[model samples]
Target: MIHLKNVHKRFQKPEGGWFDAVRDTSLHVRAGEIFGLIGFSGAGKSTLLRLINLLERPDSGSVTVDGQPLTALSASALRRARQNIGMVFQQFNLMANRTVAANIAFPLEIAGWQQADIDARVAECLDIVGLADRAQHYPAQLSGGQKQRVGIARALAPRPHVILADEPTSALDPKTTQSILDCLQDINARFGVTVVIVTHEMHVIRSICHRAALLDAGEVVEILSVQDKQVSAQSALAKSLLEVA
Candidate 1:
């Protein structure tokens, strides 16, 4: 469960003036549902995702996740709250030197988990991402898909209540992307983790999202529902995106 109300974020331009990255946007994501934020580059989908976790603190607005008002939280409180929210990046942001298991265990370690518990959680996450056999492998040794799986495993190692994936499949080939999507779908179905993904690919939304928000120039254009792999497009931008799919 996530909600953003009257959210606005602005960045100072290099020369002068400010640029609005998110403009008075409001959205709600229900528990255990896969939601999508789709838009072209500069649409601020990624910024919105980061805002949900306060990675980019909004200039004005409120962000609530799992009933916690993230915007009002103290730094320590926010740190504790973030443990329940996981993020998967477009580029697999793995530790180049750490083995798969170590990478997955990093967050747990930071959370002060006992060594035994961290070990168990890492193993379980590795299995969930189908990377059990590669637990000892380094990021450089894996294929693109394997690397992303490692990223996913790391995200799941925290037993997070929500997962924010920013273009998780964009870096992989189509077949590999499908595999990653399947893994995410399985995670949502089996674990009931609320997932919010940011992607430009329509097929990514249609394949896994229950609902999606189309964004343009840092604002929400429309929210569309997906049923049986069909996206109900109500706006011109939504229809155009669907047509391209």
Candidate 2:
């Protein structure tokens, strides 16, 4: 469903230096696979995800989704194409001004759905996330997991073709993290949406992803299958996390 070729992203530092956030990262995520991009804080995991969505354009190389060349699209065209991609942030970027239902309805509203259609989608999404009863609650009143669930609901409301999750469960406790992961797994199993998870949490990747890539120093060092069900004696990703010591 997604492909990247020789993708490079460099940022100009205030100190008159260039920082290579991503360096020639190329990988393919097949349709219906939960692909994990594991990396440390500066390993360019998030940069790679943003590159896929064109939020941060690549300095050189290409990002293609379902055969559409995202790098070559015009701004307006990219905007339209982006509608098919849904993203959830680490902070659960909900509109503080909107209620749970309103926040879930936001994406549908952006897509120009009718009020009735938006309401229907919101109801369906709330039910899927088991948050139908809390539809009136606000972010301030919800737990971290609940807020993230609302984020997932909002992302799904648009019926996106692909879901890009960045550190989705970082703030939640272990039990809550499992809950969110279960929800994600269910979404992928039921909807067949391609999931790209960029996270530092190995547990999250192992629990849900079908395949994974380990990133270190702005490069993809290794790719593995979660289905392998065997511990890596010398996992590059685990070593980056100091888990293999």
Candidate 3:
């Protein structure tokens, strides 16, 4: 449901030179599939994710989501379309001043839902993320994982069709990361939402992604499916398993 056609992103360096953060990257994310983007730092993974969300517009080429040209839309129209896409970050990015319930209700409020509707949605979302008991708690009162749960609830508040996750599990410990990964998998399977996860952790990709692309220095070097036999992803996974044991 997402397409990037020959997209290129560049930045003006302090010395008056341009650095290409993303170069000629093109990929598609199908409906109901969890797509993973893997790379070392400086591989443009974050830049690529931001392109999909229009947080950074492409300097060249286009980004289209579910047949609408994102590059062609007005700011207001883009804002409306963005409601159909949700994003979670490594930092959780929760408002420390807001309670969990208020945080989850923020998107609904922006969407202009009725007060009763917002209340019901907030309750439902709090339950979905297993934070119903902490509805009145602020970010400072929650653990890292709990804060992230609130972030997830807020992202899902609009019932978006697509979810973009950027290193979502990086901030948590392994045990907490596993828990969060399981929760994300549940969200994907239960709702049929198309998920795009950008991470450096192969274990995270293996646990949740149906397919993945390996990016190297702004180039997508390989796209592999977990279900496909004799693929590099499978081999790499096998190697990792062998090493772990």
User: Whole-model Cα lDDT per candidate?
Assistant: 0.95, 0.89, 0.87
- Minimum summed lDDT over a 10-residue window in model 3 is located at 228-237
Q: Mind sharing the TM-score for model 3?
A: 0.93
Residue-wise lDDT of candidate 3 within 138-174, one digit each (tens)? Answer: 8999999998898888988899999999899999999
- In candidate 1, stretches whose alpha carbon ends up further than 4 angstroms from where it belongs are none
lDDT of 2: 0.89
Which of the two, 1 or 3, has more TM-score?
1
Model 2 TM-score, 2 decimals: 0.94
Rank list by TM-score = 1, 2, 3
* Candidate 3 stretches greater than 4 Å from native: 228-231, 234-245
Best-first order by lDDT: 1, 2, 3
Q: What's the CA error at residue 25 for candidate 3, in Å?
A: 1.0
Per-residue alpha-carbon lDDT of candidate 1 for residues 62-113, written as tens digits (9 for 90 to 100):
9999999999999999999999999999998999989999999999999999
Superposed model 2: Cα runs more than 4 Å off: 228-245
Which prediction has more favorable TM-score, 2 or 3?
2
List the candidates' TM-scores in order: 0.99, 0.94, 0.93
